[model samples]
Target: MSISMKLSRTLGTAFTGLLLAAAISTTAQASGDSVKLEKQDWSFNGIFGTYDRGALKRGYQIYSEVCVSCHSLNYVAYRNLMDIGFEEDNVKEIAAEFEVEDGPNDEGEMYLRPARPSDRFVAPYANEKASRAANNGAFPPDLSLMVKARKGGPDYLYGLLTRYQEEAPDGMELADGMSYNEVFPGHQIAMAQPLDDDAVEYEDGTPATLVQHAKDVTTFLAWAASPEMEQRKRLGIKVMLFLFVWTGMLIALKKKIWAKLH
Candidate 1:
């Protein structure tokens, strides 16, 4: 089928899934908070609490193996590895995995070597057209900055990966170009659930569970989206410490300056 046709189908499926999810949400709200198996989403600072590190690590593995084939994280940098807890050697080792080409100026410059610690993760395809052609005109999005781009990003992403379901036996009506994503826009998605527990080796010793893998990848992607996370955290800490010290000095200065005046 044409790329447009496939995209239309995917969009239709997504729309329906969204509507179903909205209806379900409405019913739950009207019925009050007595629903079973409350699916709590992970967060950096949750309405419930923090996200899991092991989950994030496993998620990175999953992305490296599965989704990376179609999506690209162009916005992430090679140096951000330290924030996600990779050491210098591991970071360099990771950077060396991808070969990036560079060359000198117009004077018969020599080509650069393999990818370094500073280059972004390469896209699986060159551009949108290329990506679409490969996936029946469905544009596999660049994922580097996606977590920041989308609403409820991590939660949305995590849920989407795990929400594939079997369609009802009855002929289900979907949009012009969508599929049934029980957890997607139309509660039906054209892309099948691309993952299962033990989809990749859980090198971190985390249990081989779908939920665990999703969460980990989400975290990794989150870091990839903002390689500056560690720096941000460090800056925040330094700012806090500076404020505390500065406030103490201000109070002491005030006491000294007001002593005789009072």
Candidate 2:
């Protein structure tokens, strides 16, 4: 046999072995305790994708009205709401609704004042200890980076919010105060189901269903995690375009130089 023919056969056998190993690994994972996460078709999904303004507004409403009691968005400020199409005046009004601790007058005493656009979102508890105490020793994590922190990002979050079961499967025992959630690791979670149908009325007349709330909130948190995503994608596109043009020019120059040598 020719050397080239032998090399091709060897390469083909190695590729076949690699494929078989990958298939076995995937089957093992599928048979394990890992839960299959549901993927969502997010508006901000591709290089040209941008956040849905309507969803952002509705998500902010859901977070403020429903999730705010336990989770806090410490990284997001009221002024940032303008990115989601909120007017400056509306943002100010939203900020004013919450009081933040700020002070030290001539008397040197701290006092509570209405929050400003520059201030971060307020925590539900005074501190970590207080937060844990309030929730039966389970601390609620800040939602500011939750989407980025989790394994499946927005998909995992949306699943966690909407996949809660009223009761565990037969023969499964849930610890006291724990909730059953198929998407949550261990099929149990410290936090109970946060959203219900009609949990909050949407100002834009969108359906106030549990699934809708989950999607909107996931989008909002995804935005909060990476507010500059659109800008970054734009820069990437420009860079790619420049590289393509530069490569074509280089190729043409190389051909022109070789023709002179010939």
Candidate 3:
């Protein structure tokens, strides 16, 4: 056999072995011992994808009413809501809801004042120590980069929010302060079930179901993790188009130049 034929067979065998190993790893990850994250259809998924304004708004409401008590979005500001289609007046009203620490004028003492658009989201606790003390030593994580930090991203968040069970499976004993969640790592989590049906009234008349709240909150977190996603995708598309045109022009020029030699 020719050298090229032998090389092709060797490459094909390596690729087949790689695919089999991947399949085995995936199967192991999906076992009962491991967490199974649910798959979700996201609006901001593709190259041209943009956030759903209504969903994002509802998500903000969910995060505010439910997640805000424990988790903080330190990276987000009221002004950032404008990118999600919030009006300037509404952003101001929302900002004013929180009281932030401001500098003293001449007394050299800090004073509490209503938040402004420029202020970052306030934390329930003043410091990490306080946060851990409040939650029985398990620190509540900041939600700003939670989506990007997690392995499964939005799907993991959605599944975790909606996958809580009242009782653990038979023969599994849970420790104090721990809750049962099949989707959570080790099937145990420190946080209790934070969401429920009809937990919050939706202004858009959508049913405040558990799944809806989970999905909306997940979408909001996804947006928070990548606020510039839409702009980046747009730029990427433009770059790809330019490269395609450039490549075609170069190929045509090459053919025209070589034709003279022939």
The sequence of per-residue lDDT tens digits that candidate 1 reaches over residues 1-262 is: 9999999999999999999999999888788632122244555643323335566666677888999888888877667655566678877888787776677658868665667778887678878889878876578777877777765667667777666655533777754445555445546454556777888877867687887777778777776676656556667778988999999999999999999893
Residue 184 C-alpha lDDT in model 1: 53
Candidate achieving the largest lDDT: 2
> Deviation in angstroms for 54 in model 1?
2.7
In candidate 3, stretches whose alpha carbon ends up further than 4 angstroms from where it belongs are 1-7, 16-20, 23-32, 260-262
Cα-based lDDT at residue 103, candidate 3: 89
Candidate achieving higher lDDT, 1 or 3: 3
Residue lDDT tens for model 3, 1-262: 9999999999999999999999999887777476656688899988898888889999999999889999999999889999999999999899999999888858999999999988888888899999999999899999999999988999988888999999999999999999999788888899999988998899899999999998899899999989999999999999999999999999999999999994
Clashing pairs in 2: none
RMSD, every candidate, angstroms? 14.7, 2.0, 2.1
TM-score of model number 1: 0.67
Quote the positional error of residue 196 for candidate 1 in Å.
1.1
**Model 2 stretches astray by more than 4 angstroms:** 1-10, 13-17, 259-262
Of models 2 and 3, which has the larger lDDT? 2
